[model samples]
Target: MSFRWVAGRIALAMLLAAGAQSTQAADFVDSAQRRVMLPERIGRVMPAGPTAEVLVFALAPDKLIGWTRPLSAAQQRFLPAKAAHLPVIGRLSGPYPTAGLDALRRLRPDVIVDAGPISAERSGFADAIQRQSGIPYIFVDDSIERMPLILRSLGTVLGVGDRAEDLAIYAEHAIDALRGRLLIRPPNERPKVYYGRRPDGLETALPGSPANEEIDEGGVINVAAGLGRDGRIAITPAQLRAWDPNIIIAEDRPFYDSLLHDPIWRTLDAVRYKRVYLAPSLPFGWIDDPPGVNRLIGLYWLSTVFYPDMTQEDLRTQVKEFYDKFYGDKLTDAQVESLMRYAEAKAGETRRVGGEPLVGIGAALPTPVPGPGGVGTGPAPNTGLGGLGLGPPGRRVPTGGMVPLAPPTPLH
Candidate 1:
């Protein structure tokens, strides 16, 4: 071969190789600030945790390989039939053994996405998984406030910009509505609330914890706010009594079931006055557990509960709309009512406990009625907070001790 012809052939090979490289992968920065070269057209993905699963499913369900956990029978009812049948792949975090690594290799996802609070340990775990599986891993911030940005960025990374934009717009609007309405309430006017987790209701997230972000966004004062704690903390009955919250929000069904019968718990003003409420948790927790996009609906539910008259948006209608939009499930009236049963029950219980219906701020208190014995037939003085069933006045709850924890730094 002529030297010029041979040189031309070698140059052609180099150009082809470079073109292939460009087509195969592209570099992007993730929430952990890691610059990762991922497939240009990512068609398959695995979620590193439950939060990641929800995020990916919301933006690109067609690309998701499976779920971190199996859908329960009830949870299955809330999802598309095909999604309900997705295999249980487990998660990389939490107490259980790291699951689906072998399946991950077999399935050969183009990338793995881990979303939630970014931390050194979590970043390291992502790196380890990438090294082990030879798959690119992308970490995305899962902070509730940053969700819109996250969705936008993840959309660019996953080649689903249009769907992500739609989700992001909805998220931004919901968050704006929540902040615009709730943040203006004076500290004293906000209902004092305690959020209890676990079946026993002893484990709780303090204010400033990512887990309690929804409670704060809802405009209610977290009774555990100023305790200067992060993450889940176990509260003794005595400590709970000391806080004496006006309202209680429990995630566990068993805890709500036993609240009235449990002697120690019944002593709480929330339980005694029927101000305790069960937060909905089915396909996913509406409040915190995994702390993902699921909490956007939570903000609406809580705001309605705390200040019903502030907006005319009906909770049932909102719930149905949210589920249909995000979860791909069109809820029946019965399902919507069941999801809101706890809030409805609380309202009914409050009336039965002889409290007047809750009135909006600046609204006049109802006139005292003459009782059978000629005594005023109004709720006992100081027993409620402006007829909202928020227990007595003068009980001090934390107002503004939210710690300023920065998003986790990326590991070098």
Candidate 2:
């Protein structure tokens, strides 16, 4: 054959090969019920939001291209060493800044997964990203009630079904146990809870907010229920006093400390009774912040605090196991203790009451001694109430309350 004819044949052969490779891709149905075509073998993946980042990390750490946000010094401690150095790729949801298309294109992720609420806007955004980058983007449902299924689905997509099943089973078991214990309790028996979202104790998550899902699942009556709102809302002291929650769960030390000392907060029943407790937040918040897989531990923690009698398992042991399995960190005794320091003392444990200190449940004190910031400096009065885990000392409070109402500026 002539040289030109031979070159023409080679070009046609290359085109056919390319078509075959394209046809080898697999198809996936995302949470949005949208079809996404992906390479049969996905190696590098990117999370489109904070929740996706945590979920993907637990199931396929090796597949993760980078984090949605930069890890802080404290957050790095809980994550694997390699994760500490991952690039900040930004996120696509919850008011967080979206990563630049150019930046994401350079990373060359095999696919992008946005795991959380499935809304039309989000679905459209994912489609737009895919069209712009020529990459597949999938949205995975991440409601608290659907955690196990989400895990299983992710496992299937990531080609890590065994690991995914393990995590999913754990999630299902925890949810079942929590439901069994909680559903049996009478409404009156369930403690009324208020989730303090910010340091001032003025901002809080209303009912239906994903951030408070664990608390709701734990069977505690969120005082903010029926508030006709979602996410963080500012409440006046009068509103808090009117609610008179039986327990107060705060996100950080400052908020907990404020409840102990803030003059207006002190008037509330939770403060007066020393029922305020801190929620653990290090690598991620156990209770809600980002409403991710990290909250799996929150289910156990809330169950223990709300119904110590019903929780047959030891809190410390369970926490250690969770950290090891999900976070890839095995916490030491000290670490565990620090995590639970603010948790309610077990039933019958001695607590300070009336500045005299009481061994068990006792009468309410007249007023706690005011500390700096109006927090009482003395040991909090023990009212025989239980609390969730305490956060580490000096944990920096992120801007935006437990849930940021607006997307934060992109770091990249």
Candidate 3:
């Protein structure tokens, strides 16, 4: 070999070594400003929580290794075949941390992605996890207002820029439209709304709580704001009566159903006038169990409930589009009907508000009167109502491909 050829080979080797070093040291600064040196190609991703799981799944399902929690038979219907079957790897954060360092190492994920409020404590937690697991961990801000930006940022980190941009744009449009609508109506003119959680209807997302963002962004005043509390709080029926909201949205179907029969709840103007609405929680909670991108659909749905006159888009169309795009499920007419089964007030319950009858889907079925036990036994399945055969209050009957539905349980 010539001297010149050997010199050229040595130079090329040094250049390749430098390139490898650069790629190896490439760092991604997360929303918390913690610098994470990620792998050049992140193939397997483990979400730190449900919020991160949903966000990452939206951008790249193939890259997501597993779910933070197991999917119910019903929720599986709304997800991609592969995603629905992903093993339950447990969670890494929150009050209950199930995925230990051992599980993390066994999973061998390229990185751990967590999306939520970025704070010093959470940042330090990420640092600890990264150190213990010997895997790159990133914390991305999960604020509702910053969703578009978050999607784009996380997309870049996950190497799905195009997909991320598409979702980011969708989020941007949705948020911008909400802001525009809110601008049209002053805060005082907006509906005073109560968001009831759990089966009893007393558990509520306090003002400024992440769970309450859907209601807050819907241009309404949260009646619970006066409670001066943070996060979920329980209040007495007397307190709810005193605040008597213009509209009531419940997370649990049973709670919303009970409102029509419970003497105290029935006396409230919201129920008396049939202004009670049930927030959908099929594949995910529309209002907020995990408080993630799933709530985007809720934002549009809320417009129809609070200001029906202003919303011109067909709600059914909007819902199908969202499910198809985000959840990767094409909802059938039957499935859609099942979703909206009790979303609006019952047919006969609609009392005139401003001399206009509130239009709702399905025939006026008999309201379920309470049994001897005081719990209202839901009316028998009405096959004629587009497969909306009622099984029980706050539950969906499994028919065809539809699975029985219930409120989102904790991630335990």
Candidate 4:
């Protein structure tokens, strides 16, 4: 039976209860950084970040009041329905725009959830908005290691700690269980893999990032390992030849044509092996954008791709359980397979070829595994570079795929 059948009944029940008590719960939106816990029935949730909006939809669709509309074409078509209804508050941090703080205040939402790092670096804005607007603002961290803690924090403030904890515990175990079942085949048998971002480049996660970690955990070697864990560095075609990976994954679809025409790329091992993969995008934004609790699903996608023979439903269930237990929604059977189906045809067909899939990298950086003052992706935001062996504190992944732990910025 479809999981949606069960989810429908749950949503229907919550929908009715939400209509009645939305006002009371709505106050959480006004508390401004104050911790709040909503009743089991989440009512009027106003997620502030794009990635957070998508996840909040997955978590409690009925409770959300709406979210800012998507800025990109990728999001408008494939993103969640609830997004359309939510009014855009513009950028949450910095200066508010359009409605800015004023409209957000008028909305009188219950909770303002943002995955962006706001407490340490962005806190001044958070504090100002909360104090000036009369709203409670809460920040959710996306550090894989801190997921459980963040989940509990979300639950505590959302008034669903019991349910949140219950699900979080389950999220941890289920991820472990799925990982356990994906047996590691010999390196010889495993296909050579590559994760390439668009604009015709291989910009991807550094080894310490969550996606790389996910790949490693799934027992697959990242073909780009030579690039080092620092992240997607610009590479020449000659460099790719040296790597000679069997699989090439196009992180974004926009660059497919350029990859097909590249003289070096056309003759690459991954091309010959027909291991070009295209990832699924709908709840748009790279799987890692604002990488939050939803990232567990990325691990699930990798397990099935690397070990298709060993894992039948191992990967599928990860999505189901994630949507079911947490989002209370079930993707249709077709939707489930659709998510990973494009992975094999990544570079797409120059004529004939197959596809492939998000490696999790930092999903577990307890501290800067790469550096000294090692700050794990904990809730605490570390902005200093020398101390943390990371980029300037407050600066994480910027316009590029992943930011390198470069030498700290120079002082004036």
Looking at model 2, the pairs that clash are 95-407, 96-407, 261-374, 261-375, 344-387
Cα displacement (angstroms), candidate 1, residue 134, comes to 1.9
What TM-score quantifies how close candidate 3 is to the native fold?
Answer: 0.77
TM-score of each: 0.77, 0.77, 0.77, 0.63
Tens-digit lDDT track of model 2 for 78-115: 77798778888877555756676877778888888887
In the range 1-412, model 3's lDDT, one tens digit per residue, is: 5443343334334323433122244666666666778787778999999988988888888989999998899998877788899999999988788888989978999889897755578889999999987899978766566576566656766777667767866776676666566666433345567888889987887544578766656645556554432367677777788767778888887888788877877768787777888888888888887888888888777777776656657889989998888888899999989888777433233232331111111212223334457564443342221100111111111111001122222212
- CA lDDT of each prediction against the hidden true structure: 0.66, 0.66, 0.67, 0.49
Estimate, for each residue in 1-412, the C-alpha lDDT of model 1 and write its tens digit.
4443343334334323433122357666566666667776788888888888988888888889898877789888888888889887778665564575787777788988887665678778888888888888888776665676666667656777667667777776777677667656443555667888889887777644567767756655565544443466666666677666667888898888877687877777787777778998867888875789988888787776665456656778778888887888899988887787886432333221222221222212323334447564332232222101112222111233222222221211
- Top candidate on lDDT is 3
Candidate 1 has a TM-score of 0.77
Minimum summed lDDT over a 10-residue window in model 3 is located at: 395-404
Off by over 4 Å in 2: 1-24, 348-412
What's every prediction's RMSD, in angstroms? 15.6, 16.0, 16.6, 9.8
TM-score, ranked from best to worst = 3, 2, 1, 4
Worst 10 residues of 2 by lDDT: 392-401
lDDT of 4 by residue, 1-412 (tens): 4343343334323433433123245323211233333443446767766656655665556666665554465344344444444556554553343346776777777656666433455555666666776666655554443454445445545555457556656656645644565433432354555666655654655444544434445534455543344334555555566656665667676555556666657778766656566665545432464455666666556555555555546556666676566555556777667666665332222221122112232222222222346433322233332101112223233111112333222111
